[model samples]
Target: MSFLSALRRPPAAVRLNASYRATPCRSVSTSIPAASDKPAKASATATHTISSCTEGTVLGGLNWLKGQAPVTALADEEYPPWLWKLLDPKVIPDDGPGGQGEKVRLRKENRKKIRDVQFMKTQ
Candidate 1:
């Protein structure tokens, strides 16, 4: 057939015959065990009592409850700069780090810089 003729649509009869027909779905349960089956009991390697078990013992997991550090409130002197910035009323209006307005302005500035770099590369 010529290239133009080959490019044209196939005969309706050929198209109908070649159309995909899905096979009926069938599910197999080969991996599933019978209802009457019971799981085998796991054998214990060693017996342990609470007193016998150490912090390092793998048989029963670590004793995190007993090892936790006591909860204590931090003093003003111990507070980090970011925490101080949040607490201080004077710093709130200054538009330094941690301010919502400062963050938005910085983001806009970064976007402009990126766009400028991209425009330069294109030129």
Candidate 2:
């Protein structure tokens, strides 16, 4: 016998139908209990509430430095103004030969690159 058959349970006794085919044994009580009988109410037990300001009111050290200067403002100042503006989808020109097609091509290229890297790693 196979390992799975050795571990397998013997089939339960089923009632044979008039056609001589084994039929599934079902319990006589088929009616499910109605859920509407029970009264719907919230639990009485008090649950632990979490506070928004768990880090305390003190705003000194590194936190104070971060709050003083925003990261986006710093990045805007560091890079050219046009660099961030180019990221907007509306700003991108659709007049090119393959406007939407270019995006699909780029996605396929990226997928191929990922697959190639995975294949190389496996080899």
Candidate 3:
């Protein structure tokens, strides 16, 4: 009998639905003792200390340019008209003869008509 069958694992349908592997997966074993075998861990408390400012400080030689650049706000003129529609639906003018849902339905119908026309055309 197979290892899985000996263990009386769940049915193949259940196993297949889950994270199933054709071959048994190998797990890495460490040399450390199990929790039950090992002694209880002692509580560790960290002690903080502020070091003295010495002349041989490592952070001194770093290159940092001390200057500020002029910051300008991005205007609507800088953005494309389509981007405004994405940022806010209300900002976009629905100039067409129908609403948003109507436009989507028309688009889908147009795609189907194009597909039908293409299908009718030769290979």
By lDDT, the best candidate is: 3
Off by over 4 Å in 1: 1-95
| Tens-digit per-residue lDDT, 42-80, candidate 1 | 332322111222233232111237566533334334545
The superposed Cα distance between candidate 3 and the true structure at residue 78, in angstroms, equals 37
TM-score list, all predictions: 0.23, 0.22, 0.23
lDDT of 2 by residue, 39-78 (tens): 5523233322222222222211222253474212122244
- Sort by lDDT, best first: 3, 1, 2
RMSD of candidate 2 to true structure, Å: 27.6
What's the lDDT for all of these models? 0.42, 0.40, 0.43
Instruction: Give a tens-digit lDDT track for model 3, residues 72-111.
Output: 2243355465532432334434666787766877898999
- The regions of model 2 sitting more than 4 angstroms off are 1-98
Q: How close is candidate 3 to the true structure, as a TM-score?
A: 0.23
Ten residues in a row with the worst lDDT in model 3?
54-63
Candidates 2 and 3, the one with greater TM-score = 3
